[model samples]
Target: MTVWDRPEPPARPVPLDRERIVAAAVALADEGGLEAVSLRKVAARLEAGPMRLYGYIAVKEELLDLMVDEVYAEILPEERAGDWRAALGGLAHRTRRAALRHPWLADLLGGRPALGPNGLAVTEATLAALDGLADVDTVMRAVETVSAYFTGAIRREVAELRAERVSGLSKREWQRASGPHVTAMLATGRFPALARAVHDGADGDPEVSFTTGLDWVLDAVATRLTRASP
Candidate 1:
């Protein structure tokens, strides 16, 4: 056929890269949790052969790591004008908000080392906030301590959100009346303090609860830094 008569070469398929692959994987996970994401599925999403993804990611775990780092891009905060406490607290709040937006992230947070470029940037930001506050070892511990607190707190908050969704009950309502079992256990008086706290304590807003606890943790870190300083 003459060049003019030839069907325009079928449009070349869009090239697949790690970014597109990770994006497809993340969309799949967002729609259906981590279990929903597979290389084959990602490849299918991209309209490419499953093997096409292997060059970019050999296994699902690597894809998950990439997905986690992808979300970290959202978790990274804008510049702040306050001290280290404000910086770290801002980071923690951003992270919590990110996890809430992407609930699947709760499953992977702290499950493995975050060594990706974005992940390292997040770590660097956290450490940089406290860089001159104390010596290297103390600062490292402080970062770890704060990290551990928020990681566990975010996981629990996400868990509660899931549970609430399933039960169609707010956390306080769920605790007070999910079943007679909780009430019966508390009524037994074997856990008087627990019962009293449950009955007397106000179940305040979740964000407030999170912020208060984070402030407490930041305070502890501040104390450590002060003591460690010359």
Candidate 2:
């Protein structure tokens, strides 16, 4: 048969689409954390060639941006229900949990808040979450402060995880390893308060340590924001 006369094959559906490729990358991250989410690994998981993934994600950083935003989508915003304290506090907790659950997310928030759909959604949700909280400037400051604080806390926690990953140390073991530093600092009179804090804080519940500081910040901000509002 002539080439033109041969039966035309059905058009092949598009593969390696952005959404599917991004989704596969996200799944790889979720299953094995950020370290396991390389493009090659994701392609392997999707049964596609690594080059195919490049059609969707330009580079690993873009993939990370996509992943970061995807995880941000998981953070449900807190609503203003006549209790600003409850609202902001809940927002802080939710964002913190999202960062902890997907630890790489904490790293992303360190950079500027991107303007992608998921990133914009998070920014909008956060702003919307602060509805009627006084003037826009105050609201902006409050949101910025909360965002910075939560990101810092999550970063610290993730740093601990990364540090321990090398030695495979348990929480107690980490503290033990750092005990000499604490003792040395306490032995010096320069940081009495910090030494006391570390000594006292060690016995506290990990959740309490993570959640309370943000609550305190939000509490102060909410009160100040309410006072500043007309």
Candidate 3:
């Protein structure tokens, strides 16, 4: 009766593969977001009953883990082009795009649940992107710092996006939500600095803040790498 509705399976059992099952779940998550993904829903999408899915994916949590890794697989496992700065910058932007595309991906990936093959490959690519750093310690430190910045930035953007979707309000509206409380306090002029800050519209762009932070972090690493004698 519907476009996405699959035909009911025949009475006989249909063979199920774990990979195929996971793929279906991933597609469901991509289309409907995480909450719409469930054993029953995945089965329905695959044109089978809920009971049919468990033969491959034991539980919903397991299904989620698979779905999360599946998205991770989208990133290629190779060195990014150009020098370290451009390489790592590309890595950060690509990561943010991946998380935004999948929506549920940032939280699950950041939590570092078991790294499926795809997850390992992506991490390795990120590490390789740090080429030219002198020692193992420096390399590892750079990897962790860039990764922390990239993932943290992705998470914040995801939250902001969700807020924008639900409230139909831009970031300015979000700031305005605190406006009344801020205004009443300013009536007494007790906090001159705070008042001046608010009046100046000094909130600044979060996107630029993330980029600047990433650059500063890399700068510190470069400093350490340079200071250490070969």
Model 2 per-residue lDDT at 131: 72
Better of 1 and 2 by lDDT: 1
In candidate 1, what are the lDDT values of residues 67-172, reduced to their tens digit?
9989999977666426778778888888899988889999998766687777878888788878788899998898778778888999998888888888899867
* Model 3 per-residue lDDT tens digits across residues 73-132: 665535556666666677676777788788888767556534666767766666666655
lDDT of 2 by residue, 1-230 (tens): 32112333232243555566678877777666778888899889878777766655667877787777677677756444355565556666777788777776766776866656766766676677667768888888887788788778888887777778878997789889989987887898899888778767557665788788887887788688869988
Could you report the Cα RMSD, in angstroms, for every candidate shown? 7.7, 7.6, 6.4
Which candidate would rank higher by lDDT, 1 or 3?
1
Angstrom error at residue 135, model 3: 2.5
Q: Is candidate 1 or candidate 3 better by TM-score?
A: 1
> What is the lDDT of every predicted structure here?
0.81, 0.72, 0.72
lDDT of 2 at 8: 31
| Cα TM-score per model | 0.88, 0.78, 0.77
Error of 3 at 41 (Å): 2.0
lDDT of 3 at 103: 80
